[model samples]
Target: MSLSAASRPELDDTLAIRRRTLTLGLLTLTYFFSYMDRQILAILVELIKADLKLSDTQMGMLGGLAFALFYAILGIPVARLADRANRRNIIAVSLALWSVMTALCGLAQNFVQLLLARIGVGVGEAGSSPPSHSIIADLYPVEKRASAMAIYSLGVVLGGGFGTMIGGWLASQYGWRVAIIAIGVPGILLAVLVRLFVVEPKRGLSDAARVADSSRMPSIWSAFADMWRNAAARHLVLAVTLTSMIGYATSYWGPSYLQRSLGFSVGQVALIVAPIAAIIGTVSGVGGGRVADWAAKRWGIHAQSWMVGLLKCAALPFTILFFTTDVPAVAITAYVFNMLFANSYLGPTFAMLQGLAPLRTRAMWAAITLLVINLVGLGLGPTMIGVLSDALTPLVGKEESLRWALVVAVSATPWAIFHYWRAGVMLKRQQEMAA
Candidate 1:
C-alpha cells in the first residue's frame, strides 16, 4: 500500500528522531576518546618530562601549544568542508586519523617525534567537534539545544577522567607508551562503527518552517560575516576564549602543582586528582546546562545570563582560595568547585552560538569560534603560565613560581564574565530582531 504525502512527512519525522539519537550517541562517544587522548599527557607529564629530559616550557609546548596550534589553524578549512560536504563522513574519517596519530605517539622515541605525533593528533581532532555541533543543531529544536549539547559536553569530563585513571594505571604498571597505545586503538574500531551506523539528519529538520531553507546555505566567508554581524555570537566567543584560558591553565598545571606542593607520586596524583576532578567536572558540566535551561524558562532572561552571572560571582573567591591554601584537602575542595564553575559555561555558550549561526553555516561558525577559543585559550593559557613560571623561578623558586602564575592566570576569569554578560545583552537584541 502506498502512503499519502501527509503520512510520509510523519513517517520521515519519526525516522529522523531515531537517526539523530544514534548519530549523537556515537559522536559523543567518539568525542570522549578524543578528549582522553588529548588529556592523557596531563596525567603522565612527569614521566614524559623525565624520560625525554625536557623542561617545563618544552612540556607545555607539547601539551598546550603544539597540538593546539595545528588544531586551531586547520579547524577552519575542515569545518568549511564539513559545512558543505558530508559531515558524517568527515567525522568518521577524522576519528580514524586522530586515532592512528594517537597510537603513533606510543612509538615516539624522542621529544621531537612525540611532538610531531601530537601535531598529527591535533590535525585529526580539528575535524570532530564543529561537524558534530552542526549535526546536533540539525537534530534538536532551539529550546532543547543547550540541554542536548550539555549531555555531549560530558565527554570532556569522561575523557579526562578515563585518561588520568587508565593512562596513569598503565604508565604505573607498564609504561607511558603502552598507555598511549591502549587508549588510541579503540578509536579505530569506533570510527568504523560510526561510518557504519550513523546517518545524517536533514539540516534544520527540527526548526520552524520559516527558519528552515535548503537554499539558504551560505559560503564559508559569508558564514563568518554572519557571525560578525551577530553581537551575541561575538561576545560569546570572546568570553568563552578568556575563561577557557583560566580553565586550561589550571587543568594543565594542577597536576604539577599537586606533585610539587603535596609531594604526590605520579600514580598517587592520578588516583586522587583525576577521579575527583572528573566526577566534579562531569556533574557540574551537565548540571550547568540544566541550570541554564531552568533559569531561562523560569525567568524571561537569556540562558547566557545564568551562565555568565554564575561565573562572575564564583571567579574571585575560588581563585584566591585555590592558590593561597596550603592544605591539600582544602586545595582539592577549592579545585573541585573551580573546575565545576569553570566548566559550567560550556553548554550554554555553544548552544547560544549554534542558535545564532545560520543553519547552513553552523559547522563553520562553530569551527571559527573553536579556533579563537583554542588559539587564545588552549594555545596560550598553559604556555603563558609556563613562561611566568620560568621567569619567576629565580625570584620565587620553581614551586612558588607556579603558584604565583596561577594567581595571575585566575584574573582572566573576571574578564570572561564580562564578555558573557555582554553576550547576554546581545542575545536579547538578536531575539528581538528574529521576532
Candidate 2:
C-alpha cells in the first residue's frame, strides 16, 4: 500500500494543502507552548537570581546544562519510541509531561528545587521534535517540506515572544512563580487537542521508494553508523548544532543584555524588544523557508543548503556589530537583521536532515540531530557565555562583561557558516548523483 504520486494528490491540490496546513498548525502550537515552558526562565533571570541568591554560573546551569543533560540523553530513546509507536501519542504525552513539570517550577522553594524542575521539563520535552519532523516529511513532498517546517518552526518565535511578554508582565505583578505557572497551564489543554485531532500520518506517505527498503529498520547504532557514513548528514548536524549554540545563547541572554547593557528594565525589555524580536523571527522564519524552496528549484540540487550557509556567513558581521553598540535602537536594529538570517536555518536544516535520512530512521536521526543540538548548543552555549561573563566581571564590571562575552559567543557563527558550506557541497553531490 505504498502511496505514489498517482494515489497521493499533488501538494498544490486543495485537499492535500488543507490537511498539510492543519497538521502543521497543531504541531506548531504544541511547539509554541513547549518553548514557552522552556524559555520563560530567560525573562525571569534577574528575579530568580535575586530570590535564589544564585550566581550567573548557577543560573546558566539551570537554564542550560542541567536541563540539556536529561533532554539530550533521553531524546534518543524517546525517538526510538517515536519510530516504532504512535508519533501523535508521543507528542501528546510529552506535552502533558513538560507542562506539568513547568507548572511544578512555580512551586520550587529553592535554587535546587527549580533546577530539578527544569530538568523534569527538559526530560519531558525530549519527545517532541523527532516525531513531528517525521510526520511533516510524510505529509508534504520534498519540494514543499521546507516551507511546511518553516511554518511549524514559528513556534520558536511565537513561544519566545509570548513567553517573554507574558513572563515579564507576570513577574512584575504576580512574581516569577505565578509567571511560570500561568504559561504551563494552557499546554495541558493543547496536549488534549493534539491527541484528539492531530492525525498520525502514515509513515513515508510522500516517498514510498525510500520506505520500501525494510532493511533500513536497523538498531539505533546502525542508524548512527549510517549518519556517520553520510558526509552531508555529518556536516549538516555540526553546522546546525554550532549555529544552535549561538542561537540559544543569544535567545537566553538577549533580555539580560538589553537590561544590563542597554539600561532597560525587565518589563521594558520584554514589552519592547521581545515583541519586536518575535515579529522579526516570525517573518524571517517563514521567509527563510520560502527562500530555501525557491533556491532549490531555481538554482540546482542542494541549493537550499547553499542558501542557508551563505545566509549565515552574511549575518556574522552584523552580529558582531550588534554587541559593539551601546544604543538600544542601534542594537535592536542590528539584532533584527542578525535574527533574519539566524532564524532561517532551522526549517531548511530540519527538512534537509529528514530528506537525507532513510524513511524509517527519520525520527531517530531527527532525535540524534536534536540530541547534539541540546547537548552542545543548549548545554554549553549559555554556560560558556555565563562563565565568560563571570570571569570578566572583575575586569570590565558586570554589564560590560556581559557585552564582551556575547561578542565572543557570536564568533561561533563563522564556524557554523563553514560547516553549512561543507554540508551544501556534500548535499549537492548526493542529489546530483541521485538524479
Candidate 3:
C-alpha cells in the first residue's frame, strides 16, 4: 500500500489507511446515488403506467432499453477518457449530470419526454463506473481486490434498497413524480463532496508487477478485441453477461410481479423486497469476496472461478421456486436463498476481471464489460420479459404472464454456469503453464 502511494511520502501508513477508507467511502456513496437514481423508477412502474395510461412494454422500454442504450454505448468513450484524464472530475461531472436528469424524470408528462430524460441519466451514468472501478483497483492489490470491490458494490444493494423503499413510500404518500425528484436531486450534493474530498490515486499502484503502459491511448475496439482474445476473459464476460441478464430482468420486474400477481400494493411490495433483499445481498456480496479471496490463496485462482460457477448452479432451485410459487412464505423463503447465491457472484467476478485486465486497459475493459452486459442484460432482459408477457397474456392470462416471464428469465442460469466453469478450466491451464 505504501509503495503505491509512495508519491505522498509525508503521509504515514495510518494516514494512508484513513485516506483509502475515505476514498472508498466517498466512491461508495457516489455509486449508491447512481443506483438510487436509476432504480427509483422500478418502484414507480405501476403508478407511472396507470397515470400515463401506458402498457407494460412501454414501461419496460422506460426502465430498461432506453436508459441502457445510452448508458452502455457511451461508456466506452467516457471510460477511454477516464483511462487518461482526471478520473475524479469525470465522476463528479457524471454524477451531477445524471442527478439533474433524474430530477427531470419527475417533470415528464408523456412517454417521449420521460424516455429522453432517462436517456440523459444513462449518458451521465456511463462515466461513473469504469473510472470508479479503475480507482478501486489502483488502491487495493489483487489479493485484497474482491473485498474492496465488494465494499464498492454495497452501493448497488444499499442504493437499490433505499431507492425502492423510499421511492415507494414517497410515491404512496405524495406521488411517483415527487419520489423521483426527491431521490434524484441529492446526488448533486454528493458530487460536490466527491470533487472536494476524493484524491485521485496513481494508476496501477496496487499491482505487484510493474505493467508497462503506453504513451498513446488505444482505441476502444483495439482494447476490447485484445481482452476478448484472452480465453479466460472471454468466458468470464459471457458468464457475467448471462448473469446480468437474469439480474436486471428480475430487479426491474420483481416489484411489478409482487404487486400484479400476489395482490400486494406497490408500497407493500417495496417494503417487503427492499430491506430483506438489501440485507441478504449485502452480507452475501461481502462474504463472497472474502470467500473468493481465501479460495484463490488456498487453492488457486481457478478454484475461485469454480466457486462462482458452483454457486450459480446452487441457486437454480431457489430461482425456480421464487418465480413459480405464489405462497408468500414459500416464495419469499425461496427468494432469500436465491439471493444468497446469486449476489455472491458480483465481487469474485469483478476481482477476476480486474486481475485479467491489463493496466493501461483497465477502464476500457471495465467499460466493455458494462457495454456488453448492459446492452444485452439491461437493454434486452426486461424488454424480453415485457414482450414475452404480452405474448403469454392469452395463455397465462395478463396478470400471471409476468410471473411466467420471470420464470423464463431465470432459465438462462445453466448457460451462465457453463461459461464460468469454462473460465475455471482456462485458468487451470494457465496455472499449469506457470508451474
The top-ranked prediction according to lDDT is 3
Check candidate 1 and list the clashing pairs.
none
How high is each candidate's TM-score?
0.94, 0.95, 0.96
When superposed on Cα atoms, how far off is each prediction in RMSD? Answer: 2.3, 3.2, 2.7
- Cα lDDT of model 1 by residue, 7-110, tens digit: 87667667768887787789889889988988778877778888989887877888789989999889999998887788889999999999999999999989
Cα deviation in Å at residue 250, candidate 1?
1.3
lDDT of each residue in 1-435, candidate 2, tens digit only: 566766664533444346767778999999999888999999998899999798889888888998899989899999998888899899999999999999999999898899899999999999998899988998898888899889989999889999999999989999999999999989999999888877777678777465536554579999999998999999999999999888888889888888899898988977888888899899989999999988877875378778888888778877888888988788888888887877888899999888888888889999999999999999998888889899999999997988899888888788888888888899888877988
Clashing pairs in 3: none
Compared with the true structure, all predictions reach lDDT values of: 0.82, 0.87, 0.88
* Candidates sorted by TM-score, best first: 3, 2, 1
The candidates, ranked best first by lDDT, are 3, 2, 1
Looking at model 2, how many pairs of residues clash? 0
Backbone clashes in each candidate structure, one number apiece? 0, 0, 0
Question: What root-mean-square deviation over C-alphas does model 2 reach?
Answer: 3.2
Assess candidate 1 and give its TM-score to the true structure: 0.94
What's the lDDT of the predicted structure labeled candidate 3? 0.88
